[model samples]
Target: MPGRRTTTVEFVRGSVRGGRRRARSWLPSMFTLANMMCGFFAILVAFRGEYRLACALIALSVVFDIADGAVARLVGAVSPFGLQFDSLADLVSFGLAPSLLVFALFSDGRDSLDALGWIACFLWVACAAIRLARFNTTIDPTADKRYFTGLPSPGAAGVVLASVFAFADLMEGRDRLWMLLVVLVPGLLMVSNVRYRSFRSLVSPKSGKPYGLVVTVVVVLVGLATVPTVTCCVVAYSYLVSPLVVPVLTPLGRLVPDRLKEVLS
Candidate 1:
């Protein structure tokens, strides 16, 4: 009887542990689902002509996207399923949502997008899909994980969001024709050979105190609080052109403080 009771207790403990593991695994997926829902709602809102709200929803989706990956890594729940799910969620949020938002902007109250507008918006979706697909198929363990081969979808979407927010009146008027470049430039960059820094290390340094990171975050928050439109435009446009600017600025890197360099590198 004692032996049977001990075996039963061990089995119960194993089951309990297994149940907890399963629950933890679901946590990341919950965030991914939230991301997808945000994209879906963004699309709906865009159709209703709520440009700012749609852009905000897409931004919220980016937060959920980051959270899902961070949570999955924290729980050691990374899996093939999670990877595929993340890409799909990214397609909806960063690809389709932004494309629809731009299309809505160009079309306004018209029946449909013009030929150039259609092409520009479609290019964004196509390049975003290609970027995600290439990323999944070309995962290389030996390659530099700190840099992406092409512009990230979220970054491309950021360009669109920033343009809309910064040039709200321009995008609404006859001058909106030039806004096509906003979508076209970022869309093309998403498939270009230019490498973009991931900045993951800067945001979450593996070693040393995160004082630089904290300061950067505080500064960004202050900018957002004080001059949100300009701040977003500066950040988005700077990242868009960083591949070109970083090379030119590389020589000046020596002037940067060591602590700041550590956080940036």
Candidate 2:
């Protein structure tokens, strides 16, 4: 220790990192940044033909996204600025970015949907803006977590990304009409009023009995890692169908408990 020497560069680097830690205490900001970063990388990944990785990053961003709000509350750092930043990042990550990735991957530059398809991308951004705006305006004292008034925009983006990846190789030589159906359907779904499960609620409610849930989540993570492409397709498709399943079967209706009604109402 007596012979130890200190350098200005190391001290400066430490100071900068310390500053970042304090700044990152605002949790939602960190999550929002991650979402933007994911979208940024997604564009590059698609261009590089590493589509599976791109989709995975987008999915990972969704997880980070769900955490941002919760983290904001936990850290007592809720702010209008963070909220706006989240919306902007989401529009990039889940709205415009996914849309561009789809066209880039699946389209002929000369098709009619070339014009129409680009416009459809805006539906995602517009609907997401509306959804977030509605959420901010409609706050209730009740702790209700059941259904979404409409399909969540980010979930819709996930389905779109999943579809592209699921049938990545299979898409070649598929009927043009079929591709059209795939592109348009998910765009419509983003703006539809269908109930979707919100895992965000479980965070607080299950905070008490954390161990069992933690183990279960760990297992699920293992399953996801084992087969990324196939697993995402299955999960996203299952979610896309749940809205239809929810309406047709009373049993499906039962899946969304009464508390969820507050949300839809």
Candidate 3:
């Protein structure tokens, strides 16, 4: 026993061992619960007048929500319980939470509380419910995992949240009208057939010339950290318009492709 490690005889403490076993068993549920907690915390923040912080929580919730599913899939732990729990959490985080944020935008409106703005804010929830319902019903084995059928509801909510932060100062007196436009526009887009390219597939491909990408990422990070609200709005609005713009331009632009199309046609 001189230099060699000697194993010590230890008695099993059954209660302590069982407690740890139970805790480890509950890891996935803990993550799922955390997803729900994010939604609740976002609501609490919104009610407490922390609009930006509330929006940020919902955005984080979206990421956590995605991970919960991915984790379940990877671990082969998918269950009806988790699915229902996720849907409920999403309904609050992506639907109701953002709606309240939009409502706050009109709280300081010059005119009467904007009725249209209120409607637009809730529209996301309605559209989200519809989208989720459809998703549950249609289980396509052959569907492309790359692209979603319609714009995801979280993106819809993000557009509204981003607009709020982006134009925070501008929204002082114009809150009513601003919320009306931002909410309704993104809400309509969410239910539309317009297909937005999903960035989910962009994760794996590493560019050979990494320097350009690194610089691009650094510039973006700096811009975001410098003026988050404004940058978020610009980015969200750009994403909203892209799906609508690209399709329209593609067809018309295809009519004349600098003579190349003529030769091909």
TM-scores, in order shown? 0.93, 0.73, 0.72
**Top-scoring candidate (TM-score):** 1
lDDT (Cα) of model 1: 0.86
Which model, 2 or 3, shows the larger lDDT? 2
- Evaluation by TM-score, superior candidate among 1 and 2: 1
TM-score of candidate 2 versus the correct structure, residues matched by position: 0.73
Model 3 lDDT tens row, 10-41: 22456667777665545556676776787778
Per lDDT, what order, best first?
A: 1, 2, 3
lDDT of 1 by residue, 1-265 (tens): 9999999999999999999999999999999999999999999998887888888898889879878988998999998999899999999999999988888778774643477788888899999999999999999999987899889998888899888867755655556677788899999999999999885644557756666678878988899999988888888899999989999999998898897777654
How badly does each model clash, as a count of residue pairs? 0, 1, 0
Off by over 4 Å in 3: 1-29, 109-111, 204-219, 245-265
Runs in model 2 lying further than 4 Å from the true structure: 1-25, 108-113, 141-143, 173-179, 202-204, 210-219, 246-265
Question: What's the distance in Å from true for residue 178, model 2?
Answer: 3.5
The collision pairs in model 3 are none
lDDT of 1 at 93: 94
